[model samples]
Target: MSAARDSKSLSGIAINNSPHVQQLQKTAPPHLGLVCITFSKEVRFRTITRTRYLQLPEEQRETALKVLYRENLQRLDLALTFCVRNSIRLYRMPSGLFPMSDLEDEIGATVLEKMSADLAKIGQRAERLGIRMVLHPDQYVVLSSDSPHVVTTSLKILDRHARTLDLLGLPRSSWSLMNIHGGKSQRADQLVGVISELPENIKSRLTLENDEHAYSASEILQVCQRAEIPLVFDAHHHICHENLDSYDHPSVAEMLYAARETWANPDWQLVHISNGEEAFGDRKHSDLITAMPNVYREVPWIEVEAKHKEEAIARIASAGFF
Candidate 1:
């Protein structure tokens, strides 16, 4: 089947109404905010340093958790807190190992429960600072798969996290925004239905993102319209996948405008910006920042995915994003 046909099938299965469209109709387009993942360097280093979990000793495990909590959880709290104090209203947290397939062993229910408690505490802190937290998903959990096991496992992970959130008495919207990649063409229909199956409260928080290989902004918007989810754009993904001709000096302004037109939304649209470099014949994260001039006109929650977090922040500051 064609990508469009696959998207249609997914939409048919996932969306019964158009909440995002209706929302746009009711509210003026809100300025998109700038969001970042804190302590990205430490997290990436640890993950790649050791491939096998069992290779780590007890002390290493403790160290790993400390780093995970510090980077994935604590530092996020600190960054969001800073943003809030500085009048920045939006941010996204890294998905990390939180909702992975091996959560039961890598980070058990008890760990999740503790994380929830910590998040609740962070939420209270955020309320004081005026920052909104959105939890992004890891890239591996694709909903559109022929294997029922993949879909079932993904739902199970979502349920576990949802339950953990519930335990903290946080509203679904509190950490509602989740980022998901558009699935392969063959499984788009099933993916859409899976999205539709999400509870209304969760549905309100879900947003689909366009990836380098799977879909484009226009394609994702159509699926979002049908799935009742909002659409998010990743600038790097677009350039890496669609605008390779201009990769070295990408037209950030034109791309953002095109994405906005595709989604036709003015209400606090979410976007991601990253630096990409060729490594082993594949695009990998690099230390590049979005050109502020191109995106200043639109209020977007920008996350700098670079080789180094401090460098990314420096670039953003130099560009006057702060």
Candidate 2:
């Protein structure tokens, strides 16, 4: 495919290496997303943990919260602009984009109001640039858990993510997906059941992904098919999953084709690509992607989970792999 429109500077938010981005224009359909952090030294993103915030002296904590939130919001704005310039069509926004927004009830409410304007503006920026946004809710969102406490906590975490999207003005639709795993449970039925209980707003944005540990491509596909959730087939994770048996399994190409069936508009289908650290199923991510699955060339979008971020995208571009 032809490259996207040229990215003019946005609000003077300096993108560190846009010249590199411009040269790596796409020749195809599956655009790559740089997972969260960038290699840009001028724009390092920061996030704060809830524990550290709680441990601070009450007085000292107040200023600390606003500073981190402001910095991250500004970073989010810059990242979207970077994607536009880089021809990076997709972006998996950091799950921790807003620290402790839902964990501390009193604080979350205050922070949300302060962040409303920036969030709304950036959401508009993403859509206008035609940059698809993806949010992979972190390990903390365990909706499949049986315990009410864990499930409740997980709900809060998800709500926080959904709320962020709402403020950002992304429609509650597949245009922007909130991709996640099946969580710590093995029972596909349990996960499917949990999907039934979710609010439509959250459910609408949710897309289940197959992970290396708990969920395999087929198992998660069962949930997707049953629950009507879109499948985000992870090529590396599918290779490394624990469920492959002595019996023959489907090839990566076949599984990806099957997963693509879950999406309504096939053009928006997404897949995750990452290289294993040492061997095929190791959870650790390689700093750079040596190669990508040929099947992915037919797919719509990809999120590269490499430690080197933008450099990895440049690697595949320079090689003309896609």
Judging by TM-score against the true structure, name the best candidate.
2
Per-candidate TM equals: 0.66, 0.85
lDDT, each prediction? 0.54, 0.75
**Native-to-model Cα distance after best TM-score fit, residue 94 in candidate 1, in Å:** 2.9
Backbone atom clashes (below 3 Å) for every candidate: 8, 2
Q: If candidate 2 were superposed on the true structure by all CA atoms, what would the RMSD be?
A: 10.2
Name the regions of candidate 2 deviating beyond 4 angstroms. 1-27, 57-62, 242-250
Off by over 4 Å in 1: 1-89, 97-107, 110-118, 164-171, 244-265, 278-282, 290-296, 320-322
lDDT, candidate 2, 1-322, per-residue tens: 1010111211121222433211112356578888887876634678777788888887776577788888888988888878777788788888877777886545754777677898898888888888888899888777787687988888888888888888899999876888888987577887888888889879998999998888888889989999998999887788777433211133566677778889887778888888767744466888877646655666778888898899998886676555
RMSD of each: 9.7, 10.2
Model 1: ten consecutive residues of lowest lDDT: 3-12
